[model samples]
Target: MWLVLAFAVAGGLAQLVDGTLGMGFGVTSATVLLALGVAPATASAATHAAKLPTTLISGLSHWREGNIDVRILLRVALPGMVGGFLGAVVLTSISLEAAKGWMAGLLLFFGFVILLRFGFGFRLIPVPKNGERTRWLAPIGVLGGFVDATGGGGWGPVVTPSLMTVTRHEPRKVVGTVNAAEFAVAVSVSTGFVTGAAHQDIPWLPVLGLVLGGVCIAPIAARLAGRLPHAPMGTMVGGLVILVNLVTVVSLLGGLPGWLDAILIVAWLALVGRLAWRAWEKEKAGRLAVVGNPGVNA
Candidate 1:
């Protein structure tokens, strides 16, 4: 019971960060769950199950902001649904240990890409323009859906950036639209999981706790988002992601000795403490900026 509560609190904090920063929910939730001794597949399933309603709420908020592109959603959703189904099936068949190794590698690659200083960073695929390129939406949707189901999170890391690059939308608009569209994906995939072969592993209590916690914190995070400077906020989020991936890699590779795990946990606590302090400073600065320059507005 207490463990469930702890997981819920951890998930809520993750949701707060994700809601405000435009990313991090899946990775954060999945990592924390794994650290708690849950199987990777089970953790992914539980997280997705819980995220369905939470994403819907956030997506609706984004929609009210006029950030959704209905046409784009219509184009991608069917393929995404199919891909998510397929991915879930695949996950059921895979070895959890192997999946963890692959997931760690992918996370490391993504982190490295994000850390790049210049010249294309991590994006290799060029943004598709109009016509046939837009048609690529189905395949992209399929892959994103599949990976997200299997990995526990890919909306922000895979789908949002891809859509933004392809459609040339503003970052904020992309974030909003992606959040909305992901609600659809999460709902579809989660429904399939509930009815399909993967239903047995569902951790009902923990999942419910996570959903409730996320619901409570989401609005608060969203409200804070508009107040922070984009560049610094993005950098901080990216840095945190990098640190998380590094830890994931070390843990997966058996590089973290027994003694080192304790040290890493302490470091993790310190890192999160620093993040909170920085966020407070940023919020204060933003408020001051607004007060000192009345005409400037984000």
Candidate 2:
């Protein structure tokens, strides 16, 4: 009972962050589930499935707000669908449990990426002209989808930053389009996992709990998308990624102390306080890198 409640809380928090920041639901939820002894395939499947509703609502909201670029959606979605399915099949064919050490490492690496990219005043290449065919979107979509499925969550983290910094599109628009595209990625990954090795592996109870929690915050998160101090949430979630995965890796080594779990709770609380108190200073950093900088692709 307590375990299921924990999963629900994690799922809700994960979606809240993803809804505002455009990533983290799958990464956060999958990490928790994996740490709880859920099989990797099952964790991936459940996380994607759980994401379906939240993404749908969040995407629709973004679209209504004119934050999505239809052309980019088509370009990314088509390839992303293919990559998501293939990735699911490929992962199901392998022994993900046996490879969890590598999986933990992968999540940890991305955790750092999120921290540095979003935390330390990171910027990237200019956005390509609207629909001018950078020729890079296709491959990136494919690769992002593949990684998303295999790792349980990489689409937003993998794709969002690249699109934001590389293309110089409006950060909000890039975020919305990536989120809209996630609908397709989530669907494809879920379907693939359902028919693949994890067909019977869905944790219905925990998934339902997560779904309920996520649904409660979907609308609120959508509204907060562009308005919130995303970096703080980004940092918070990244901290969770590192903290949780680090614990998982350690447990793999030996029995983890009960006190360490208590410390993690404290660390999380401290980060939240730090983020809230530093909001003004971080905002001065201009994390969004405003739309018209004269260096854009248009």
Candidate 3:
């Protein structure tokens, strides 16, 4: 009972972050589950399963907001589904111990990407002016789907940024299209896991907890999305993910010195805190400037 409640809370918190920032639910949830020693395949399966309802709801919201591009959605989603299914199958085929190290490493990589992107304000290549072909999106979708299924989450972090770099669409449209396509990826990944040999290992109870918690918080998250500061939230989530996966990676490498681990963690915390503070200050200053110059074009 206590365990289920704990999972519910985790799910709710993850959804809160993802809803506000438009990403992180799977990564955050997977980090927690993996830190608790869950198998990689099971964790991915559970996250994808839980995502079914949430992604559907998210897609609908974006559609209503006029954020989706139906053409982009179909193109990316079809390839994403194929890649997600294959990724799930490959992950399930691996032994748990081996899969753990790989998943941890992948999550760590993702954490760093997120940290660099939000904390350091790293920007992707500029989108060319209708010069890039949409066909290229297929490969991006394939990679994003594979990563998301194998690492427990990465579709938005991978697909959204990649699309923004090469496509001529508005940033909001790219975000919305990537999100809408995730529903298909989730379905395909879930199907793959259900049909996999290790399907029996899935933790249905925790999955139920995640689903219920995420569903309950979805509407609230949607409301908060426009209200919260994105950079701070993104940095916080990235830092947390990095810390969690760093421990896992260190353990897989036969453990780090306790003092070294402590030092690394402390340094990371300081850096993340500084970045988040700076982001908050920047946002506050921007708001103040906008208010002060009411007639100036923002």
Candidate 4:
């Protein structure tokens, strides 16, 4: 009962984050389950299973809220479905120990990417004035799906940021589109996990708890999507992903010295705080400018 409650809470929290930010449900839930000694295959399977209903509700809520782009959703979701299934098959074929390492590395990479993109506003390429050409979306979808299936959560983290960078769309639209597209990815990944040859027994209790908690919060989270400040939320989520995965990597590396761990965490927190403050200041300035010059198009 206690375990079920714990997962329920975790699921609610993860869904809140994912629905608002367009990512984190799988990453957060899988991280917790892995920490609790669940197998990689099982963890990924459970995460996707839980995500099915949650993503469905989230997508619909976003659609009702006018956050979706039908063209973007179809383009990204179809390729993502294929990639997700392939990724699940690949993950299931690998040995347990290797899969853990793979997940750790993938999570760490995505964490850093999130931090760079959101926290520091790093961009590798220039943004086009109108919008990015649609040709690039298919590849992005494939990559996002592959990573999400293999890492237990990445479609949003990968697809959302990538879209935001290339397109001129608002944050709410990008987040909504990613969250909506995730329903398809979840369906494909779940199917792959079930059909995989070395399928493990899923933790159905946790899945149920996650589903219930996530469903309850889906509408609220969708409503918050257009209202919340993206920078602070993105920075916080990136920091969390990095921190949690760091702990997993440390455990895999025969553990780190207690002092070193504390120092590392403190340093990371300081960086996250600095970035978040800068983002807040920038946003404040932008709002002030708009208020000062109501005639100008901000």
Candidate 5:
């Protein structure tokens, strides 16, 4: 009961954040599962399975809201699906405890990329269909899919940042397209886990709890992303990505002391706060600067 409730709540919160910010669902949910001592392979399988519903709902909402790019979705999703399948197979064969460390490091690296994007106000847009730059999505999708399946969660963390840094699309659209594409990745990862891993590996109750909880909030999160101002949300999502991965990295490094945890959290909060203030100031300035003629009045 308590366990079920915890999983349900965690899933809901994760979905909400993922939907709103374009990332965090799998990593957040998997982090919690790992803390509860779930096996790595099982955790990855369960996370992928749980993502089925959340991603479906989220993708639908984004599609309806005109946030997705069909071409981008197809291009990236196909490779991601292939990568996810391969990653799941690798996870089953490798010593996951060792693999987990590498995954954490990789995620942490991307977390910093996201922060750099937000910190510097990068405005990378997508190129034309015929442009060579558009081809980069294939490799990004491949890496994203592989890491996501093996790490139990990282598609958005990896895909979103890479796309944002290189692509010419708006952040909101990229988030939506990536999320919409994630349906394929999630499905592929789950199939790999179910057929390749031990049949009894997944914990059914936790999977059910997460799915039930995530379904309810999935639409709401997509709507929020569509409506929310991009800059502020980017800061929030970037900060959160870094913070969450830092915790994971810390835990992997034999866990931190109480004071260290507090210090890290406080620092994280301070960075978000500063970014938030800057976003607000920019918004206020934009609002004040109407496009009306500056001709002399009267």
Candidate 6:
């Protein structure tokens, strides 16, 4: 019971973060559950299933707000779904420890990318104005789908930034489109897992707890999203992704000196606290901006 409650709390927190930032629920929930002795396979599968409804709801909200780009979805999500199914099959056959190590490395790299963005502002990549850039969408979809299937949550980390670099859309629009695309990927992957690997014996209590907690608090996150500025919100979300990835990597590395772990933990906490404070201030300022400048729709 205590364990179930803990999982529920973690899920709620993850969902809150994801709802506001457009991603991370699966990664957070799966990482926590994996640490609590759930098998990696089961953890990934259960988290995928548990996050389905939440993603759908959040994606619909973003769509209604005019965030989704249906053209991109058509080009990207189809390949992503296929890739997710293939990735799941591969994950079932891999050794858990090896998968964890690889996932850790990927997460660490993602973190490094975020930190780079923080230290140096986003470096815009020049792409042909013509639709040739969309040619990359299929490959990105495959990679994002594979990562999400293997790591439990990587769609945003891999897909959103890539799309932003190539497409150069507004930050909020990018986030909303990513969330909308993720709904399709998550649904496809979760459906495949449920049908093909039902024998894995998922922890239903924890899954149910996560689903309920996530669903209940998701609206709050959406509200907060509307109240925040795009640039700062992107920065905050990117920073959190990096910090979380760093922690996951360090934990997976296992043999780091105790002092190093302490340092990493402290740094993560400080970074997160600072980002949260900045976000709060930005939200207040954004609300004021919206009221004062009626032209600013965001």
Choose 5 or 6, whichever is better by lDDT: 5
Ranking of models by lDDT: 4, 3, 2, 5, 6, 1
Give the Cα error of residue 58 in candidate 4, in Å: 0.1
Q: What TM-score goes with each of the models?
A: 0.76, 0.84, 0.90, 0.92, 0.81, 0.78
Best by TM-score: 4
- Candidate 4 has which clashing residue pairs, if any? none
The residue pairs that clash in candidate 1, if any, are none
The candidate maximizing lDDT is: 4
Off by over 4 Å in 1: 1-5, 111-133, 221-227, 230-252, 256-298
Reference-based lDDT, residue 213, model 4: 86
Candidate 2 stretches with Cα past 4 Å from truth are: 1-8, 123-133, 253-280, 284-298
Q: State the displacement of the C-alpha of residue 269, model 3, in Å, after optimal TM-score superposition.
A: 1.7
The global C-alpha lDDT for each of the candidates, from Candidate 1 onward, is 0.66, 0.78, 0.82, 0.85, 0.77, 0.69
Give the 10-residue window scoring lowest on summed lDDT in candidate 2.
Answer: 289-298
Candidate 3 accuracy as lDDT: 0.82
lDDT (Cα, tens digit) per residue for candidate 4, span 170-209 = 8888889999999999999989998895346888899888
Off by over 4 Å in 5: 119-132, 165-167, 230-244, 254-258, 283-298
Q: For candidate 5, write residues 199-284 as lDDT tens digits.
A: 36778888888988888888877778745554565566667766766787788889989898999799888988798679757754
Worst 10 residues of 3 by lDDT: 218-227
lDDT of 6 at 117: 43
Q: What is the lDDT of residue 117 in candidate 4?
A: 71
lDDT, candidate 3, 207-277, per-residue tens: 88888788777666655555677678888888989999989988987998899989999998998999888
